[model samples]
Target chain A: MNISEERAQAWRADLRSSMKAKERTEIPRVHMPELDAEYRSHSRLEEVNLGLSAEQAMLEAKRCLDCANPTCMEGCPVGIDIPRFVKNIERGEFLEAAKALKETSALPAVCGRVCPQEKQCEERCMHLKMKKESVAIGHLERFAADYERESGSISVPTVAPANNIKIAAVGSGPAGLAFAGDMAKLGYEVVVFEALHEIGGVLKYGIPEFRLPNDIVDVEIQNLQSMGVHFVTNCVVGKTISIKDLEDDGFKGIFVASGAGLPRFMNIKGENLVGVMSSNEYLTRVNLMDAANPESDTPVFKGKKVAIIGGGNTAMDSVRTARRLGAERALIVYRRSEVEMPARLEEVKHAKEEGIEFWTLHNPIEYIGNEQGRVTHMLLQVMELGEPDASGRRSPIEIPGKTELIEIDEVVVSVGVSPNPLIPQSVEGLEVTKWGTVVVNNDTMQSAVPIIFAGGDIVRGGATVILAMGDGRRAAKAMDEWINKKS
Target chain B: MNKIVSKEYFSANVIKFEVEAPLIAKARKAGHFVMVKVGLKGERIPLTIADADLQKGTITLVVQKMGVSSSKLCALEAGDFITDMVGPLGKATHIENFGTVVCACGGVGTAPMMPIVAALKKAGNRVITVIAARTKDLIILEEQMRINSDEVIVMTDDGSYGNKGLVTNGVESVINREKVDLCVTIGPAIMMKFVSQLTKKYEVPTLASLNTIMVDGTGMCGACRVSVGGKTKFVCVDGPEFDAHLVDFDEMLMRLGGYRDIEREENELYKEALSSK
Candidate 1:
């Protein structure tokens, strides 16, 4: 056995020996420190969730029962070895925990920050069954990842011997990065094509800095680069270089993760008004193009009263961003109640703390515009929850004759997004669903075209970063197996 | 990074660049444009692919120094590298034998019209080109337009060129003399609005290539959205070209001015930085 294998075995044996379940359970969960709500919202946009200290991380790690049957693993989309990583952190081997995370996830820091743990891993925690708050797995995961990064000696995953195969991934988003990492680890030449000037796709442009800092995403990208993944930015796969062109350039496998960036509007009156735009546009401008700056080339309209429409994480991001941009009143005009909101619980809480008003059970019917064609007011329809709909969430039905007109300078529509149509339309044999998402085999993530595979927003419409990464890892394994079998 | 192969000055503020972009040069059609970024902080401005030399692996872009990004692009000389250039975006202009086609353009709009004129002329249409600018010195691509079209009429608002009239006047003159089956207008929104109005009187079908505010040249950002036929359409994907009559030119003109103040501020900063250097 290799020296590293021997070390891993010894480490596992030590962790198995220290199984003081009762004593570990006695320790309480650690709460993540955050910037002062009043100060953070009014001042510069800084990271709110302050990372756990070393002692705090280890203490929180002890709360994990490390059950014989680790159900948290099943809850995770990537199926990260939850017990192993948590136990490593418990033993104060933070670097080892991060390495364990890297075995499955290409972006531990990112997923730790943005992942909806309440619905995922933490939801399945054994501590939850014990009538106590579940162990802060997300916080611990972040601590380990951040610890490893700050230690100055980052770990690169072990790569296999070169197979002399070439792979191409469209969009440098989480899915594409994960696929590139895995393919590179298997010793295949991987190249990621990003449509925008900057890499990191939605992570860089969609998510705001206060929640998921750009540097954290950049670090994860740097890790992928170390794994032999080449990034070609400012190159749109369908427009800059088509699928046929990639095939001709000797790329044997193609993975499209071009993302669902086309934002959907309410189709209401005055939607095309001057101050009205999509959450994607609003975030892309502020986050990616620095449009919040007054002297920026493409400055976003700084409205006095900004309203974001929707009940998702994007809506929360847009609303919070508005507050930072000095919006006197930053409000979320969601159609459904708070319980039905798709945004993470932590994000909603943080938004509330940042003074974002939630106007739940109210939907905008029309945006009234002034003579200058700028949005001046919004006509809202009060709603009430009715019978559970197809998705099992109670459907919001409009309350008849309960309309109210509210004044607003700007409105960001964050209802949803559609899959980008470039790749699906460009590739001749590629099957596309009615929703414009590429139809792929569920098991393999492969498209109708034999050499092409797709995942992330392109395949799943709009989904979480972790789910996209899961699709990437699964596609990598399937592509590797298929390529070997063909050869 | 695409290298600028050649640079030619048409006027004090307008310049044409031939950049090395082999794939875009090969795939680009008449109406398609490339998103050009001059520097790290430069805005991704969409410039029409004025011409392409497939043999030389290059694409031409005519830029008017209207904002900071355009000025930065125009300042670059031959052999300088463009930070990022993604291309051949938007639906290409539909060229067909419409018997007699009237191609009307103003200022830098003449650049995009050159390729369409050539394509229409080659497709067996008697192309009558009307190139307009404020003055004779501001007129661009007259030689190229003459080479492509059967007849080239230069219109100067200040009457310093072939004719003293607006682009609509030139287009109206052609419509009165000949049966203009199709009119292709590529210019300022105001100019296209007037041209479309003139063509509507003659009942000639007209197509206008719109230039809207865009972040990503791809259909990702709806910043380039324009109302066409009472429906919202992304100019980056659905078209840079649309039916002239159905387009809401006034709203589009308003949307285009969304970044005007910001651009002026940036231009001032750029000038200050230049003076400091």
Candidate 2:
């Protein structure tokens, strides 16, 4: 499927004919290639979105309408030059489009897969506001980045002359990686310290391979590494070496993007039963721990009846993973209605197609376990949606005397998670909210400790990958400003 | 990657694996733990250094088949390779000329105590070690304890071995007859709690080793946090060994049981699968 330079140029001219505002408005929304749902459901690992072909990418780029104001950039977290990149792709300059994306986004490939673009970039599209289809910006982003990576020519961003400055980023998640990428581009001797054995904090451990494959993460990480960003895995900033030690060791600035890795569980009756576990533990074991293998060190239980709690993306991942692990009855038991599910429409649809039963308007009150202490059944209390709550989501009110028992062997509780408290708790004099999140200057991402800055889940509690990356980009700028002024 | 030099099943669940980790074997001291990733996809599980042979360049870990992590660890046989091993983590026990030391070891705690006892003996201190478990078969590291200690006392609840009572009896009798400079307890929270109270009665200095929940044996994750002297302290970084008097055993005990249900469920399934095999 290689497009020659001459044919690509001819196609670009053909695309240019339809690139006019009036003609572009008539173009339909480009469809993304998807893996067969039936085949995907039976497999444990593999990306669902097969990614876009070069022709599809060109068509999607041509539908952008090349806005004069480019409101899509305003919607983007990292403020990627959406029109310039799309127009470049439309003009048959695929590599230039990737370079344009790299100017702003540290993880274009990852953002393409995980970012909620529909609510952001696409929502801000002119056609979308006119009650028409918006350009498939995410698909194009993935296509250009994938094209660049597969083409065996990754253009490294121009790094500044080494100012002989040293900066440290704690945790190698989206935010930390983003900061590290920008800091290295600024020619500061940057080092990213990660506590886990593998790099790419949440990207590697949290999201399953089906969403964002590890190889894609590796490519992004490798780019940073090639740009002189050093990474030290299995090194915790606080415990292994104190924050004070880092300052003493000549680190001009430190960025704490340790992320929200803590798993929260529901405090319900019999929640402590053997088969009841948090989605964090379940996913970490199954996704990261190689627990599917009976011979592996952490073998996750493959139950006949698996009920996943919560309606978030994590819950979808857990239920889908449970199905892959051979659950005969994989169910999603959420308190809210289907409309209020926090999971993406694509994921929800994928789960439905895979035979995942949805028990909406229901919340588990207790997990019934056998004498041996393994969860055997779940007693759920029926619920109905109430008025909008503080978070702008409808509250669920439990109906009294309405209970249902479902025979089950496993329960994956994916309610939510708190920010990792290691950085705030370990460093003395750092201000942390009652919720254990680090308090930082919103503009600078700098904490009370002048030398230390914080972002990502550590500051925002928990957020989407792109939001965290946005914080990283802003923090990097502020850090550079502060460090430069001091020097 | 590390190769398992030798592996032996102590009991149905307890396993002792010796891995070929030269750097860790040479650098690790008592109270230090290593985070072991069984395979590329394995989750990091913290395992305290039961013993390390610098000359042989091997570190021994005596892991019990308790949860999914440990069960998977126990399933490994000799010649199996571990994906990652990070550490000699946490603070090493502060050893000194504490004239006479009382080592109270329960269950798997006996394994960690052996090295500390050996280090104390090498430092020319008189060491008396009390090893206890539910039954005779459950007791471990008795031979190692005897080799390392000046004197040894064994206690079991079922009266299957030595004194038919708690290890507290041995400690009380030993402390009464001798000027015990420091009393160190390593075991279950209940045993350590009782030991801490017993030592407080005699006004003796006490140190208790904690095996808290830890994700990264490094200080990055606060999952292994325990209240020490009323301040939150991470066991992986601050101290797996702490003052028994100021340490919050109640909090530690409660947090330790936090995942018991899920652990038990996985254990049952694993046992079922193992038996079928």
Candidate 3:
């Protein structure tokens, strides 16, 4: 055998021996440090998960089997080289591990924080087949990226020579940033236009700082900027400049990632009460605007008792925010039981620990207001689980004559959102789904108009950050090919 | 960023500014509005398109310093850059040669009336306008309204200026004098409600321009929803201008005051901050 192969075998033997000798082999997945429940319940703006230490990350990275066929990679939306990165961490190559992740993900730190790893990569781990605890991949990802960032030696990914082709990216969200990064990597001039004054579309405006800090998102965007991606803030694509105007300005291609910012409301009796608001507005006003501050020009309501409707990650966030705003009682009034909730289990656990009450199987029917026209109470109809619906979850059925009134000073509705229809309305002959999502080629993310393309919530209604980035990457590759053929 | 071309204050609370927005200038019509943001943390407030100079690529906006946002906008200098300004949005008023058209405007509402009056007169209809305010100092767009409309009448609540009365009294006079085909009122929801009630008695077809709490100024966020004829409609997309008789102003007034106390506290804080600075 060759000397390199012989050395590789020797290294494998040493690692296996060291792993077998330690009792850590039997240790379950490493636990992430969290804020004290009592302390955190009163505070709304501190990150609950304190993140993993280097020692803990090493322990989890060592648990990776480094399978010849990594199914975990398959489950990842961006198809990251999971085993390579994990093995890099095992070899003490922390910077290399981060580089490996940057090759696939535009926002490694963001995905590490918000992505549903338990449902994706972790679920497909080889240890799951043996009924053993899977490696803490998400935690390790966060650790490696954070380590590199804190180490003050962040190196942007390499890119090709400038090709001088200009591309327009609508909205600087995860999807737009991802697409811009890939296009810039291929030597194209990329410009991301955001309608809001600030960049990072929903990541900056919709998400609370306690969950995903603005600084982290800022660093990721900085990396893209360092790689030659230009950003133009306060430019709404359709209104500020039309698609035809973009074409006239000599942009070769356009990518729409404007996202679904629209908020939906239940048209029930007394919904027009002063205190009723969609979660989008509540979060945007609090997070994007300095509305939570009484000193800000636009201030949000600090309700004594706030009720968040629907059961999702946003609902949990709204309830948690209301608690932080000094709500004496923050409750989740959902129509379905806990089992049917769509929120990540970790968020649900965090909400529970923070003293948020979950009133499952209760659907709001009407709201009652005082003489001041502010909501004072919400009337709910008790619900029962019925047969499984098309989504494979049991549908909630209202129980007749079983109603109760919940005294609430505020109601934050987290029902759902439809795609923003500005681009669709501004452009002619662009196909859109009934749900207002832009119709596109699933493989290429190219819309019916060859000059235009779309991704993220504009194409998927609402989705995870990783899924949107995946669409952006696929669009980048396809756009590269299409542009090359055209040229 | 759009550059502010000129700014003039009409009163302690009312300010008129012309901005260079070529796209909006090209598309702006009567009864349309734009969403303006002063900075990254600024709240988006909709202002009616008071006038547009297409050749100069400028759109005029008249703002009243009522809340924290409007106060911030009023603090800007002529050469200052407005961070964001979207649209020429909402459906433009349907101006046809409906014989004699009477425009009833309240306070600063005279600004949005200028374009509608010009459009109706250009379409071969005689335009008669009633402009009223709390006091003479609060009245705006007087010369512009005069130049556009065939006839003009003015009033003030406390006899601080022209004939002492409300805008509804002027609407009654114009309807009684002329064979009014349609009446368009641009003012506060409460004022429009009163005018609509008067026009109903005179059997004058009336249109009321509405203002509501909005987020995106697009059809996306339903924050600016209003009930008209028992139907839910988004003001940003469907109709900012609707049949005055069909609109339920009570519901709108309640919804518009949703965060009144919070806004008041915020404005106090802003004033303190400015004073300290």
The best candidate by TM-score is 1
List, residue by residue over A174-196, the lDDT tens digit for candidate 3. Answer: 89999999999999999999877
In model 1, what is the error at residue A143, expressed in angstroms?
Answer: 0.7
The single-chain TM-score for chain B of candidate 2 is: 0.94
lDDT of 1 by residue, B51-113 (tens): 999999999999898888888888899989999899889888888788999999999999988
- Alpha-carbon shift of residue B226 in model 2 (angstroms): 12
Better of 1 and 2 by TM-score: 1
| Per-residue alpha-carbon lDDT of candidate 1 for residues A1-487, written as tens digits (9 for 90 to 100) | 4323533676656765576777777787788999999988875458999999998987888777766678887899888888788878878888889999998899999999999988999999888887888888899889989999999879999988888888999999989998998999999999999988899999998999999999999999999998888999878878867899999999999999999867898788889988999999999888888777654566678888999999899999999999998999999998889999999999999999999999999999999887778889999999999999999999999999999999999999999999998888788988999999999999899999989999999999999999999999999999999999998
- Interface quality of candidate 2 as DockQ: 0.20
Clash pairs, candidate 1, are none
Evaluate model 2: give its TM-score: 0.80
For residues B1-277, write the lDDT of model 2, one tens digit per residue. Answer: 7889999878887889999987677667888888887656566777789899878889999988767667677878899888777777777889888899999998888888878998898888999999988999889888888887999999999899988888888899898898999999998888999999999999999999888776555544355666678666667766889999988787677667656765676668767887999
RMSD to the true structure for each prediction, in A, is 2.1, 6.5, 3.1
Q: Give TM per candidate.
A: 0.97, 0.80, 0.94
TM-score of chain B of each: 0.98, 0.94, 0.98
Q: How would you order the candidates by DockQ, starting with the best?
A: 1, 3, 2
For residue A85, what is the lDDT in candidate 3? 73
Per-residue lDDT tens digits for candidate 2, residues A422-479, read 6776798899998889999999999999999999989998788999999999999999
